[model samples]
Target chain A: MPPRKPASKDPEPLPRSARKDLTRAKLLQAALTLMGEGRSFTSLGLREIAREAGLVPNAFYRHFRNTDELGLVLVEDVGITLRRLLREARKMDVAPRDMLRRSVSVYLEYVKLNRLQFLFISSERSGGSRILRLAIRNDVTHFTNEMAQDFRIRGLYAQLPTASLQMVCGMIVMTMLAAATDVLDLPPDQPLLEAEMSENFVQQLKIILFGATRLNDALTRS
Target chain B: MPPRKPASKDPEPLPRSARKDLTRAKLLQAALTLMGEGRSFTSLGLREIAREAGLVPNAFYRHFRNTDELGLVLVEDVGITLRRLLREARKMDVAPRDMLRRSVSVYLEYVKLNRLQFLFISSERSGGSRILRLAIRNDVTHFTNEMAQDFRIRGLYAQLPTASLQMVCGMIVMTMLAAATDVLDLPPDQPLLEAEMSENFVQQLKIILFGATRLNDALTRS
Candidate 1:
């Protein structure tokens, strides 16, 4: 007898604030997917992105001023995500080699999860929106500084100077992005087997880290 | 004027074929410049590139279909240059350590000299141009094969398989790009001033080779 009642006429729409955040997040996610597919932000229009997010073109402005602003926000988010991954890895009690391996696993995992944001930052280093480029530099600077502190605390870098550590961090970031983009296979978006690539990635990273460490030791002895 | 030239007039423009090649080269050069400045080809218009090359818009299509075609040509040029650089370096009589050091020097020197071309290829990875992306991959494959041959001849890599050597080559490519990006801010690009960074690069390459060699040796002993 209770089944006779009709469904409610309408469900409530998202609250204005919630809807705004949702729209922004949707746009960013869409951007990440598009960018991951090797599409550059320059070739991407706001309307195209808005359509991808299933929102009207004008509604895009409700979340941000324009695509560039949206990209900057995405870059910052990527930076934060990258930093958090490093921080979490630092807390684990794994062997240094395993820690790096896990770090790379997390890195590849993050890229898979946030492909667009990573692609945006990666592409910007070469062909990104102006705001995205600036954001990348700013974020990488902050990231390098963070690593410098970690290196100092670990005393693994006692012989090397602070700037040296920054250089290593920068090298690592560049290599990471280069490796990620290479494996992603640019436009047409081939799905790389992350598990296999991550294994190779760890080996490469270890080679870099081990080599850096030994070189520092050799110089100290000399 | 000594008996002034009779019927003085401007020389006819370059021959049609000559003009076409000149235009193609100019377009490629302009693409490199813009790409080197971190501009994406997709975002850049044919007119702007034509302007950069000191040509009118219609003159652009005379050379190529679009900027994507121009980009692929530039990628091929880059690969050829790199191949030549390595081939020349391979002919020098130097110790393995010195050879690697010199190879790195050559690489960095090339980047400095051909900054635009190098930057363009690195940044154009994510451009939605199929042919251009394939060109990049072709170059990478060619470079890897060349490096593999070098390792085979050196005997240092005799114990490692061809695939492993290719992996090392990939690492080398990745590291060289990272170094050129100056993302690390490691001194100036001056090879002499960059002794530390350059040394670091060589040391890392050495470690990868040496480490693999040692690992293989240990396995044999076991």
Candidate 2:
């Protein structure tokens, strides 16, 4: 008997594009898990990552050209994710003091939710990979620029020069990154230590914001 | 003729202890050079470091049990070097504004002189190795405590609470470290970029100090 052709009405259960996306995501997840385990990306092997994702070594090439390419993608993804979250946090209408506290709280909460991504960015910010380091720095520069714009819109530090505003924004980014590093480094068993770290981070931001306000006032008077 | 034993009046050309000390110093120097070249200590191999130092792999054991131990020694040496330089900077009797500028100048000079050591500390501060990260943090904490003590002696920040004093000192240290990282990461031929970073650092510190003085005044009035 002759074989009958399938009708066009029947749809494919899982399309090729979707399956490829799943595999790519799995590879990224594997990398994030390994980094979350305290291993830097430079120390990770392509084969190890592929194996963790349950694929053959050659399958990695289908997703990424190499580990550095994968790392760049990861850095970009984390940067976008963080900026989106922070932007959302800034949308809240609150007093300046409350806004500062709320922004920090939102940031810390994001770090908690995306522990591996935060850890990867913080660790690789000064890690061995120059490309990854540059990517993180670029993202940080973008973040600072956005922050400076926000400050300008709010008329905060309006009297300061553009360079000074960038400096203040840069300080805020660095301090937040440092706090995230400290939080991620804490052992999981030490809840008290984590709480203290969170509180201290808030207090540190308060001090910095206070100083920034005073500087703005002085510059205006001068 | 049989080799004659050294006479009581004859001194050894290179004493065993002195030779051992030189070998140890060579190892540390080799590691610093590697780190300055953008290779993190955690990514470095023991054999490679020994080879760079012109010593056999086994010879490394005499100086350190492992790379982590060598890293610990490096951290300690950098900490001591920085503390000594900062202490010298603090000894200058000048007005508070001039003092801030001078201290920053002195610190930047030290960074210029010891670029490798500073790079090592900054890179490893948030690097992969937990032990190295902890060692750097401990040194930073020690530096902050010493700064707080000096502040107490000079009646600086006298109106602030002890925790607030430490917070200010911690912010200063973190800011300096961030600036150091920027300077180290700059291209060697970019002197203009380096100068701008240095100028920006000084200005940033001035803003912080100005804010700190205001805080002190407000607390005093309250």
Candidate 3:
């Protein structure tokens, strides 16, 4: 075989814009990695994050004005990522029961695969950053609104008040988040333990769903 | 008016043990105050805490070996305070519906009254301290176990498996904690807003209880 032409030299060196984007992504991932080790974003230093990203401290400013700014961006990214996955799960053409099971499975898988992102989210949900906390709360409210709309579309609780629907959706979201935190907090080597937690989480979710449906029926009839 | 003997010159100085206890309480309260301001325990310095408590840095060692030790003590204290309040609420003689309404009200009121303690617990939950996180988790588990026993005694969900009961208890606890955090995170001047949030929280709890009861009946029938 020919020598492959030295992989085309620089392979058309990345454009300035793309290079900037790459650096920003690297910085965000580095922060995520540090946060995943249990340090809150407030405790994390800008220099440390820049070092972790293999960039100088000054380069950090090219992406974010400060750590809080970076944290806000991370919060937005996590919110978008989570909402997109859940929305896709809701879009699947499956039976209601299977949809729920699949949705939860996907969510847990995402939490496991994006350990750093989820860790950043869970920690910051009530961590030291006020802006991040509010950002998460807004995302939760937005997610709840989206879930309420999906339920309305499906006619799952057609007679229930909109507020009631929001309440139910909020509970489900909070439960799923709590479960994700619990699973991630477990020792990484404990696959068996993690599986058990996953099963328990599903059971808990089923119980809540069963209860919510029954309540909706009762309310409509009364 | 009598001079009252100038209030006695000695004034019966506090006993040594009482003085020690007061100092410990002061230190803990200082930590709580700092954590309440959106700072995680891991971000807190011993000297800062000591200063807040109006003591020298070296004096902090008299109460705790290090910040983690102080944090562990704080976790235990918070757990005890929470468990006691919940136990008292559970002991009230009222209908099931009233019981839940009253319990949540009491819980929220406690959160308001002990804002600092709740803030500490909320922050440390997923904070950087592994030991503190585990301590909180164990307290939660213990609290759930106690609730399960109480449910059994009350003839609630009598036919459900213990694990299922635990799941229910865990959900309730998580919901209450989330609610507490929400209330505390709100601006201090929002009385009207706080009341509205309280009402919404009550409604959400009612829905969960309604669903749990229906599930219990169904499980019994099946």
TM-score of 1: 0.80
Q: Write candidate 3's Cα lDDT for A46-145 as tens digits.
A: 9999999999999999999999999899988988887877677676845865666676777888888878877887887887777888897788788888
Give candidate 1's error at residue A94 in angstroms: 2.9
At residue B158, candidate 2 shows an lDDT of: 93
Residue pair clashes in candidate 2: none
Models, CA RMSD each: 4.7, 3.9, 3.7
Query: Per-candidate TM-score, first chain only?
Result: 0.80, 0.90, 0.89
Worst 10 residues of 3 chain B by lDDT: B93-102
- lDDT-based ranking, best first? 2, 3, 1
- For this target, which candidate reaches the highest lDDT against the unseen true structure? 2
Off-target runs (Cα >4 Å) in candidate 2 are: A1-12, A189-191, B1-12
Model 3 misplaced regions, further than 4 Å: A1-12, B1-12
DockQ, prediction 3: 0.59
Please tell me which predicted candidate would have the highest DockQ against the true structure. Answer: 3
TM-score of each model, paired residue for residue:
0.80, 0.91, 0.91
- For the record, the alpha-carbon RMSD of candidate 3 to the native fold, in angstroms, is 3.7
lDDT: worst 10-residue window of model 1 chain A: A185-194
